[model samples]
Target chain A: MTVATFEASAPFHIPRWLAPFVVLSFAYIAVPFIGTNYLFEAILLPFLALSLAGVGLNILTGYAGQVSLGSAAFLAVGAFAAYNFNLRIEGLPLIGSIILSGFVAAAIGIVFGLPSLRLKGFYLAVSTLAAQFFVQWALTKFSWFSNDSASGVIDAPSLSIAGIAFNGAVGRYIFSLTIVSLLTFFAYRLVSSQTGRNFIAVRDNETAARIIGVPVLKTKLIAFAISSFIIGVAGVLWAFTYLRTVEPAGFNLDRSFQILFIIILGGLASIRGAFFGAALLVVSPLILSRLGSFLFGDLFNSGVLDMSQRIVLGALIILFLILEPDGLVSLWDRIRKRSVARLNKRKHVGRAAQPTQ
Target chain B: MSGFDWQFFVEVLIGGLLSGVMYSLVAIGFVLIYKTSGVLNFAQGAMLLFAALTFVSLVERGVPFALALIITFAVMVVIGIAIERVVLRPLTNRSPMTLFMATLGLSYILEGAAQLIWGTQVHGLDLGIDDVPFEVGGVLISQFDLFAAAIAAALVLFLSVFFRYTRVGLAFRAVADDQFAALAVGLRLPRIWATVWAVAGLVALVAGLLWGARLGVQFSLSLVVLKALPVLVLGGFDSIPGAIVGGLLIGATEKLAEVYIGEYFGGGTESWFAYVVALAFLLIRPSGIFGQKLVERV
Candidate 1:
């Protein structure tokens, strides 16, 4: 469909209820600058980086339908590559370094992704795990990646846009927000394009997609490349602006699995679900811990129950997958429709039920 | 020192075979579970650790080693039955991907629960058997390794007999081959599934004991089963014999790599050497040595 026709035919224009929500979210995202230094450093920046990583993964697993269990390895590639570029290039622009890191990550992702051409389903998962071990091993063993640091850790160089340093919490937060927002806008556009449709089509049915002229191999590889590139950039920001110093263990299987859980919890196919899922994975545990403390005082403390937290979380993931495979985004959609129906019911009586059907 | 030391080669080969037997024990548990449920039980390693911990603790608390081993096997049977009833039964007819995720979750739960029940500290397990290395024709070998290898061979032999000769075993293979067809012919699907899980648990208990005896019982003991994964990939997911052969191949190569190739890389190559073996096999024959090639009906 032409862009003009698509705009004209679109149903359910942005509702009044959602319009306020959008504006409020934007303000909340911007208003975090007023918080204390610890809150920004300890909370918001890491959360943003993790959420961006979640979005990058959702594009691959959720949209492209390739299950990746080694996303952390890609993130590590980005962070370490960006570090090397910044150190070696001498007068290299920061933006150029960040973009180059993504390209490096994409190259590594493709190398690991080659097995996917022959493997599928659970077999593919096991294969991806090799990437996790191999990359982590390299990071730990090859001291050059960490610049021969004593502890095998890399420290992010200070960020500068043409020598205007973003050194403080406020400056870093603004820089991260602008980059994440821009990347998110581009992701949204990409997901709606022909390439995106082809990915979803292949995901839904590879055979059917191939029959209909979708280049299966090219589409899958492109999805992997794009996904890794975005995740790599996020990793660069994660290290440079968020963590400041990173060890190999920080980007292991746990982070990859956590990101998978987030995307799955949010909604598989929806782009906006990335934030919802990231919020759950990142913030829900903290919220749950606080709630647990309030309810149980000192007896059933969060730390003691931390191990149990995994059991419960595992249970919840299975429960959500079984009961509501469409995830929290679908639940949100359902609630909005119901409320709209309830209001119309008072005005039109019996007509509301039919419209819902 | 000498041209082609015959005794050293024999010694390394024997050692490799012994370690391979232990790996096969774990892979066999994996094969049994995969055959019946069509789910790769990632928790097999964790189950091994849990079983080993339970066995050692019971023995440490004054139960005889023999009694502890038997009691642990029985407990495994019960645990297997519970898993089939509580976890697998509820999610019957879900997609394979969902089942895979559920198993992954189960692994986390099992690992955590094992740690909580048995403190995270490593404990030395004494099997009441001599571990001293003995020599035959100038080739020194540990009796513990030989005994473990013997036990593995005997277990596989018994399973082979049980599956091929017994009525219950026949039911298992029938169910594995075609669940719907077996059901159509008046077979009880749930009963067969329960039985298969019980057998898997029994194998896990034995595997756990031997592994713990060698490595010492700890939470990380579960990672050794990861060594079995490459075995599964190389042997094909469903082949029992493949598990045995794959295990041996991995065991020999891992040791050789650590001793030979690891010198160039400053050692620690054993941590991931087996995966490299599995990856190479996957690149060559993705279906595995004994696994049936998947023909997707497009």
Candidate 2:
């Protein structure tokens, strides 16, 4: 073997081209110069935050095989907890507040994850709704969470690290990109570990996993802790970096459904599926509105467009579940394989025709 | 605090139990679908909303009440059949979660379609019963609530009779008992499922109209399904009797909580108290009071 040749084997069969260097340059370097203000503010900011949350949910529901419909509640907990930490502590930095808030949310996630030890399937899913309603009610009922603002909306703390402040869309985007990257990298490592295998074992068959000496309860709890910690951080990005404000209403059940839809549309159990799903989710509404305006010429207003979006989204979920349960990533894989096969056939025919010239 | 007002407590309990029958109406829809197919139909709320919206919109256009009911029922039947044929059929044998998600998608479709067809305006439905509370022995009760309670009891009675005496009902029970065995014995799975879904849709219509009259026909009507989840958690996913009892317990407890302890929590505990009761029940009895015990085989 050549000296330059090295080999590596990971448990996950990552399909293709999740190159760190290429993606980093495109996000941090190339985009800053070429992209417009609106692109950074409206599109990339929320997209990045949702991508982070999607990754968090995928870790739990996708990898761990325990479904949750209470993600928005966790997001709210993170946002509010971070808000409180930053507000109450005299000189704690914004980043410290975020990390601490993530731990708080993780603690709560474990509390709710207790139910999963006893329940399964729809039972677990339905009970999680308790988190959704209870969180929303508590946040709204207790004015203390919002610093007695009376409006129940709290402004996010100013973002600054050491001597640098995230002042505008580009600055905030870059700041969020840093945290999301670091966290996503840890998550990427997590799924490829032995703990991740134990999760899959528990998911596929709990009896078998238990028989084989897997600490089933701990694995599930760990999954919940890690997933909620990540989701909590994503909530920090969502409120402070993306929306610039936090409220209980902002992280309602609809937001949870949106995040769940992301993992499902992206492809469950795949890291990149989260990104693909987040991208489709962020982009599709823009596409739908554009298509609506172009085709109907104001005959279909925003309300009608909104309704159509719901219809389209619902139809896509059903269609995907029926036709392609593996999600958009699998569909991309199919197209890529077809083109590669075609190129191989063409290359062989070209070699035969030229007679090895 | 003040000499233990038994009369006031009993009044609240009666009112809650009566309102719970309304919740039971919705929970029954969920129980029907879950029993036969093992799919907890999240779209039950959207179906409720759709049915109410359809009936209200038709009535507003001057259609007779009886005629509007028939047309709405027909629409629900069509929707049930379409769901069975299009979504559930292709998705058969999948995990319960997968099927549940499909129904979640189905809810979105139904909610959107309901609004698209009938514009998004809230309509006040008058069910022709006087709503003013009448007092009897220092206790007050509304006539509309009694009317609703009576209808629910009738529905329960009719449903039990149908399940006991009808051929399709026997097939439904067979499928619910064991789908594989039912298929082995030549039971028509699709038809039974279709029938069950139709019955669920009918239940939704009944719930929607009652809830619509109480709260108005609007998008929030779909949220009634959220209330039903706790009832299912309390009663079990498969038993109709469980749904009714659970709903009654949830209704009585939530109302009681709101009146007694809502102030300590700054009021508005009604939104989530049922879920808490149901969740506590789950910790003690996972299958529910009347639900079949699930024995998991390796």
Candidate 3:
């Protein structure tokens, strides 16, 4: 089906949520002007990068019905590819380097996605760990990736587009925000199209999707490629814009789990859920720390607090999976539906009273 | 080629085989859980770490070795039952992926709890066996390696007998074949699942002691699971025999590759070698060497 027809037939109208989403987008864009550098640098940049990664993962695991535990591998590939391209290729623009890195990541993604044709479910998920370990090993073992640095840590060069250097917190924020917004828009459009329908079909039932002429293998590969490309770009943003330097260790298995957790907690099969998940993951730790210090004062140390945070995070993940498998987006949708019902009842009551008068 | 020593190669092969048995110890836990419940228990590594830490900590507190072992076993049983009740029971009828993710969450909880309780300090676990290398047929072998292999062999023998002769064993096999059919026949799935998890926990404890003795009880003990993944993939996830054979194959090949070919790659090929091997094996037999073939219906 066409994107327009799909949207028209959707149970929930987009227009109802469009106003608040627009306002939120504007406020996000305006954050640099109104907020502190700490907010822009420490929080917003990482959130956007993680949100983009969540979006990438959401497309594959959420819509396409393939679970990957190696997204950080793609992210590592993206960051390193971008760094190498900018370093070796003379006169290559930074934007070109980042985009090229995405293509590089997509190529590797296709290679790893090959097994998904033969494997299903958790078997496929376990297989993806090969990608995770292999990529990290390659990046660490081969000194060339780090430009033969003894420490194996590489600094991301300043991001510049035609002499416009995104060197500061605000500059990096705007640059990442623009990239995320554009990619998110494309992701939304793609998911609403016939291709998106194919993903959902394959996810719901692969054999049925194949019988319906969905080209199951090709669809799975495309999902992998697209997901890798977006995640790869996020890696570039993470390394160049947020952290400004990285080692392979930075994108280890924990990072992969964190991104997966974001998508799970946000909502599967929803674009907006990626952002919601990212926000929760990034902000929750800050809130937890604040709460810990407030309640315990000097009684609890930072290390103890860190352990407590992990326990809380773990518990929350299990709780969400058991209680609200659809994630925060579905929770928000439920609340919205209920409020709308209550508002309609109030309006009907007012109309009936006026008629009686 | 001229300087290639046949003796060293033989020694390496023997050493790899012995170490492979240790990996089999861990992979067996995975197979037990997967066979009965169809859940890939990601928390197996964390359980290993927890079991090892608890045992070592108890022993360090001047408790007798046998007492410490019993207490650790009891703790694992409790944890297994608690998990089966609280996590897996509520998660019944959910997709395998959801259950897998829940196990991932369980891993985090177990890891955090282990560190919190045990103070995150690395401890050396001595199983009263000296690890000094002893010469055998012109090859150097560790006494500890021989001990580990013996323990693994005994565990396997005992498990095989338990599965064959016990009433619970019959129930386990019935459930593994068909959960619904077993339920129809008056078998309790929750109890069976709990039993399987407890068996897995017991396996983890044995693996933990052996691994901890070799590498010292540390956080990195959890990473031994990575080495076992190749074994799991190679041997089919649900087959006990697969875990054993796959473990041996992975262990031997990884060591051989490291010793012979690692020089070309500047060493450290052992880390990813098994995964690459498993990936290649998947290309040939997607179900693994002993895993049941996957059947899908529209």
In model 3, where do residues sit more than 4 Å from their true spots?
A1-25, A350-357, B295-298
* lDDT of the structure predicted as candidate 1: 0.80
lDDT over C-alpha atoms for residue A268 of model 3 = 88
lDDT of 2 by residue, A1-357 (tens): 111111122212223344566898799999989989989888899999899999999999998998999999889999999999999999998889999999998998999899888887777888888888888999998899999987689898889999799968899999999999999889888988999888889888898999999999999999999999999999989999999877798898889999999999999988778888999999999999999899998888987887888889999899999999989888886775456545545666654432110
Ranking 1 against 3 by TM-score, winner = 3
lDDT of 1 by residue, B1-298 (tens): 5587777777887787779888889999999988877878877887898899898888878998789878888888887888788778877887666677777667767776777676677889887889999999899998999899899999999999999999998888888788899899999877777788788888888898899989999977888767788788778788899999988898888777776578898777766777778878888887888887872211
TM-score result, candidate 3 = 0.95
On the 0 to 100 scale, the lDDT of residue B77 in model 2 is: 98
All candidates' TM-scores? 0.91, 0.95, 0.95
Interface Cα root-mean-square deviation for all models: 2.8, 2.3, 2.5
- Residue B42, model 1: lDDT of 78
Candidates in order have lDDT scores of 0.80, 0.89, 0.89
Stretches off by above 4 angstroms in model 2 are: A1-18, A347-357, B295-298
From the highest TM-score down, the ranking of the candidates is 2, 3, 1
Q: Better model by DockQ, 2 or 3?
A: 2
